[model samples]
Target: MSPDFLLLYVNDPDASAGFYGKLLDRAPLDARPGFVMFKLDSGMRLGLWGTETVKPAPNAPGGFEIGWPVGSDADVDQMADDWAARGISIIQQPETMGFGRTFTALDPDGHRLRVYQPALRP
Candidate 1:
């Protein structure tokens, strides 16, 4: 069996759509007033729907945010620059942890998303 895609529900579709659009450099697919979808290169679809309509899975606190993995610290820097330029809130500046470098951003519904990748392979 194979896994399908994931969809997130947000309080504001326009803000969520705009955020993902700038981040992904493309407009959402199958967009409607109440929903939008991002078709990632990984064949996984990230979708946004009206918050009031979502039914969270058991054992889940609503739905957790998504992430984008970059290749290096430089890439993380560039991502933060781009996101800031687009007026998206960068909750945390890029910083190196024991495992890697990362930055967090809050989406429309206040979900925190972190983008990161391995610092080095041990």
Candidate 2:
């Protein structure tokens, strides 16, 4: 099966699209009142669909998180700050963990967005 796409159920596709467009620094590949899709640098497609429009509406909100890996701890910190400056809510501050330094933020629709820096291995 293919693993190149992810769809997020949103309360309002247009608002979600605007929020993500600014966050990602790009426009959607396709956008309508009910849906929006974005092609990331990794070639993965991220879609935002109106919750009420989905065939099987999401059972509930926030069962998953989308993660972004950066080159280093500094980068993770920088992203967290950047996102906060843009009005994104930083739910978790940057902190080092087994994997690396990381921070978590909430998207307009309350989806968890995480940025991390992988710990180096010997």
Who wins the lDDT comparison? 2
Q: Where in model 2 is the C-alpha error above 4 Å?
A: none
lDDT of 1 by residue, 1-122 (tens): 87667877677778888887887889787788778888888988888887655665223223476778898898988988887887778889999998799998777677677889877776
Tell me how candidate 2 scores on lDDT.
Answer: 0.90
lDDT of 1 at 113: 78
Give the per-residue lDDT digits (tens) of candidate 2, residues 14-36: 98999999989999999877999
Q: Candidate 2: which pairs clash?
A: none
> Clashing residue pairs, candidate 1?
none
Query: What's the lDDT for all of these models?
Result: 0.79, 0.90
Off by over 4 Å in 1: 55-63
Query: Which whole-number lDDT from 0 to 100 does residue 101 have in model 2?
Result: 97
